[model samples]
Target: MKIVTKRDRVSLRRRVDQGTEEQRAIVQSILDDVKANGDKAVLAYTEKFDAVQLEDYKVTKEEMEDAFASVDGEFVEILEEAAANIRSFHQKQSSQSWFDTSEDGTVLGQKITPLEAAGVYVPGGTAAYPSSVFMNVIPAQVAGVERVVMVTPPGKDGKVPDGVLLAAHILGVADVYKVGGAQAIAALAYGTETVPAVDKITGPGNVFVALAKREVFGDVDIDMIAGPSEIAVLADDTAKAHEVAADLLSQAEHDARSSSVLVTTSQALAENVQTEVEDQLKSLPREDIARRSVEDYGMIIVCDTWEEAIETVNEIAPEHLEVITADPIQELGKIKHAGAIFLGPYSSEPVGDYFAGPNHVLPTNGTARFSSPLNVDDFVKKSSVISYSAQALQKNVDKIARFARLEGLEAHARAVETRKERWK
Candidate 1:
């Protein structure tokens, strides 16, 4: 990690990855093919990219049972507990349909409706993310979405990982499909024989998946285009060096582009953390990847004052923020932006990543400034409901007409006028 004595020299903003033209063209071609050919194109791409050919892309009930049986009982218990926690937290975020009526009998309200169906794309290949399964599906389920379809690439044996399958099984999400990449996204955006088109798609993927989400955004809703994982720790002299260093590397091992930064008021602590990060990096199993991430994007900045440290954190607006000060909660009000704020030493980032109730799918890069972490709201749609009684329409008809005509919308003006005349 690079150590900087001056806060002015620190810059943690990473350039967002918008796919290359070639990648974009490829994604468009795949989308076009999937739209036209449906499951045929999906299978072809699955075989080409994943090196597995399958007669059916959908996972069978037997497969689910087998996956559940294959995993040990203890781990399954853990997943169930985590799912319960996630469900409990997100249930609080669910909204109800509400209405209000006035003396004139104008009924106005907001109707909250969960999406008819939602697609969750879980990444597969070298690793399996059962955590992704829980984080993505449980919220949609809590929001009352009926159909939650899951898609992940098949392994060389043409089977979904047991852990991923078990997680979905625990959540009662049976519509698991053996597909992935941009083609999987296309299938979700546009319905196929095996996979149903969804109202919204939520999950993280590679460059191609990101570009596909960007391309198919209007056709179907999607979660934010997530960037690489990032963590910014706001620590002071009271923070332990080893614990802070370990938390930083947890994100660093995610990808070479992942960033780990520390902003602290104590220069001596900064130097100690710099040494701790180096010593800790040597032992990480993914040492090469973590080292590259720390060397390229990680930083340790020594700020002159606590205000400067807080200001620096807001500037970064990291995906995850850990405040490990003497009194971590006391600094909460000063934090203006962060996808997920982890307070104190025990409240590590991974705690929220797996077992904690908060959704792990957070806004990445500098988007935390304007965006938010994934929650129940992402799986539902809000429609404004308006019912104007005869008396109310009569009172506001002329004003409504004038306002519409002011914008040069003659049709809109006449539409309201016609309604008023009919009521009269």
Candidate 2:
């Protein structure tokens, strides 16, 4: 494991702080090819990378039917249950377009409108994620998106993952295609002959997929430029060392570069957790990945006070923060940054990742300072409403016109003044 003393540290930020330049070039190349060649380029990359041939890039109704039948009935029930939880949690975010009329006959309100279509990209390499389908699609559903489309790479055997297909069906996603990587994002951002365009895309993916999202931001909305998974556990001596170690390894198992950290005031607790991490690492199925992740990005910061522990957490701004100290709630109030806060021992990172009813496609790599977790707001747009009676118009029109003129936008000023005759 890598150890850094507080004094000798060159930078306090964690190992996942910045992006490597190599992935940037590949992403740029993919963006250019997709923009230039459209559907043809995307399909070609799909064939070469995924080793699958496609007569057409769009998913057919027959394929979806087969996907539903392939899965077990019990699993389907679970999917329904998970979807319900996700929907219920996100429903609180739902908003309406309303109008308020004043005595002066002025009507003003705000309009909440869903995007025409939202594209979700589920990772297709080495794993299948039905849970991700819930996290990404349910928010768009709650926001009343007209359509939620999905893109994922097919297996070498020319089939997409059953979990992905089943989740798509459960979430009412009509569109699915056999594509992945930067090319998939391009196809979604700018509609090709084969793939329909989308207004936004959301999900956790590899570096290539993340870079693709970053490049396509203006062309279409993206959730966040996600990085390797990370977690920081703020524990006191009262916390179980084994539980802390297990939670740390959970994130480390994600990728070789994923970060797992323990910030605590108890030196004895830190030592015990380190021992537990080694003992438990032997039994893990993905021990190699977890080991490398811990070696590369893991750390144990021993601080003197709980305040110091939280200060370190703010400095890191981890993607996930688990407050497992004596007073987890008090620590939560102190934490102003972090994409998601997992309170208490039971609220580990995996709970949020799997079934906690919160979206796991969180901001990473210090982006917690400015970004937020994926939610209904990501799929919806808000519009401000403004209406004024003659009396109200007369009261504010001059101020509006003058403000526009002050900004040298005469056209905007004239646009407001155009209605001046009625008020006069």
Candidate 3:
């Protein structure tokens, strides 16, 4: 790992900060095609890219049943537990429609209404993340969203992941389709002959999927356009170097683009973690990805004090932050920017990503400065409602009429003025 001295490193975000425009153009074209041709375009892309032939895009009841049988009972039980935890946490975030009445007989307030439908895109071409199924669907269910439609790429034998199916079942998501990539996003944003259009789309995939979500955001509300995974650990001599190294590798294994950084006050701790990372990488399943990430993006900064480490952390605004220090809570108070903050040694990034109640779909690539993790708010919308009795309208009509006329909206002004005439 490269060592960055406080004097050497630039303010950090001096790094390459935006997606390639070429990628944006390619994804935009895919989204446009899907919007125009619907399911026909989606199926063609799936066959061309994923190499899966599909007679029908929709997964049958029989396929779901078969997927359930293929999975172990123990894994299914774990899914149930994770789903329960997710639902319990999101239930607290749920809001209800409310109204306020005045003495003048006016009733006005904002109403919180869940989207009629939500589309969840599960990327199946590269890897399966059953944990993501819990993250995307559970919040929607908690927000009282109706008709959750899910799409995933199929295997060579035309079978979806068993864990994905079981997770969908646990989250009360009945609709499943075999579609993937940007085309899948288009189908959800715009109605297809086979798949119904959704009011919102949520979940993570590759660059193509992220680009697709960005393209479809206005047409159908989307959770976020996620980038690469990242984890920043702020540690002191109190933290176990081995555990810190292992946690860093865990996130680095996500992809070569993924970043894992350690900011510590101890030069000895930094050196120990560097050695531990090499030793631990020998046994990891995705050692090549982790190794490449560590070589290129990973860094260990030996700072003068905890305050210097925190200053560096705030500048980075990493997607995941693990604060392993003498007092985790006290250190955490200094952190103002991070998608999610892991309190201590036991609360790793994967803990929140899988079993923990919080949503794992976090802001990545330094976006935590302004963005947030996916939540119940992503699935529900608020609308300001206004109503007034005769007396209330009579008193407010002149003001309303004047405001509209000031904006050169004659019809709007007339509408309010007419109400005043009726009130009289």
Which predicted model would earn the best lDDT? 1
TM of each candidate vs. truth: 0.97, 0.92, 0.92
Residues 115-187, model 1: lDDT tens digits: 9999999988668999999999999999999999999989999999999999999999989999999999999
Per-candidate clashes, comma-separated: 0, 0, 0
lDDT of 1 at 349: 97
Q: Which stretches of candidate 3 lie over 4 Å from their true place?
A: 11-25, 396-424
Q: How accurate locally, in lDDT, is each candidate?
A: 0.92, 0.85, 0.85
Q: Candidate 1 clash total?
A: 0
Q: For model 3, which pairs clash?
A: none
* Candidate 3 local lDDT, 41-157, one digit each (tens): 888888888887787988888877887888889988887888888889988988888899999999999999889999998878557878888888888888888789999888887
Candidate with better TM-score, 1 vs 2: 1
